[model samples]
Target: MSTLSFLLLFLSTFAFIAGGSAAKSWALSDNNWGLLVLTLALYSAGNLIMLRLVRDLGMGVALSLSGFVQLLAVNVVAFFIFGESIAPLHAAGLVLGIVAVALMTYPV
Candidate 1:
C-alpha cells in the first residue's frame, strides 16, 4: 500500500475512533446533545475520507485494511483509554483476528 493511502486511512480511522469515544461519552452523560452531534460529524467526515480511500484502493482492499486498522486501534483505545480488559481466550482470538486481517490485506 502507498504511504499516502496509509496516512489517509489512519486519519479516517482516527476520526471514527474519536466518534466512537464521543458516543460512549454521550451514553455516559445525561442528555448531552453536543457530544452526539460531534459523534455524527466525525463519522460523516470519516466516511467522506473513505470515499477517497475506496477510489485509491479497491473496495475490498480499502475496507479490509480499514477494518484491520480499526480492530487494533479500537482495542488499544478501549483497553488503555477506557480501562477495559479482555479475557485471555478473547485475547487469543484477537491475535487470530490480526493474522486473518494480515492474510486478507497482504499483497496479491
Candidate 2:
C-alpha cells in the first residue's frame, strides 16, 4: 500500500480503538452522553477511512491489516495508558500476532 493509505489506515485503527475504550468507560459510568457521542463520531470516521483503504488496498488485505493493527495498538494503549498488566501469555500472543501479520503482508 502507498504511504498515504497506510497512514490513513493507522489513524483509522487508532480512532476505532480509542472510541471503543471511550464507550467502555461510558458503559461503566452512570451518565456520559458526551462520551457516547464521541464514540459514535469516531467510529463513523474510522469506518469511512476503512472504506477508502479498502478501495486502495483491497478488502482482504486492508481489513486484515487494520484488524491486526487495532489489536496491537489497543493492547499497547491499555498497558501503558490504562495501567493494565500484560501477562506472559498475552505477550506471547502479541508476538505471534506480529509474526502472522508479517507473513500475511509480505510482498507476494
Candidate 3:
C-alpha cells in the first residue's frame, strides 16, 4: 500500500480502538452518558474514514485486515494500558482469529 493509504488505515484503526477503550472505561450510564456519546461519535467518524480507506482498497481485503487490526489494538491496549491479562487460551484464540482473517481475505 501507498504511504497515504497506510496512514489513513492506521488512523482509522487507532480512532476505533481508542473510542472502544473510552466506552469500556465509562460504562456507567448516568454519570458517563456524555462520554459514551462522545465515544460513539468518534467511532462513527472513524468508521467513515475507514469506509473511505476501504473504498480506495477493496472491501474483502480492507475489512479482513481491519478485523485483525481492531482485535490486536483492543487487546494490546487492554493488556498494557489497562493492566488486564489474558489467559493462554485467549491468546491462542487471538492467533486463530488472525489466521482466520488471513485465510478468508487471501486473494483466491
Give the candidate order by descending TM-score.
1, 3, 2
- The TM-scores of all predictions, comma-separated, are 0.91, 0.82, 0.85
Q: On residues 1-108, what C-alpha lDDT tens digit does candidate 3 reach at each position?
A: 788778888888988988988887787455687788889987998899888877888887788778878887888898888888879998899899988987886777
> Which candidate number maximizes lDDT?
1
| Model 3 stretches with alpha carbons more than 4 Å out | 28-30, 105-108
- Per-residue lDDT tens digits for candidate 1, residues 33-65, read 999999999999999999999999999999989
Ranking by lDDT: 1, 2, 3
Best-matching candidate per TM-score: 1
Least accurate stretch of 10 residues (summed lDDT) in model 1?
Answer: 22-31
Report how far off residue 95 is in candidate 3 (Å). 1.4
lDDT of 2 by residue, 3-89 (tens): 999799888998898898888788878878998999999899999999999999999889888877887888877777777787899
Worst 10 residues of 3 by lDDT: 24-33
Model 3 residue-pair collision total? 0
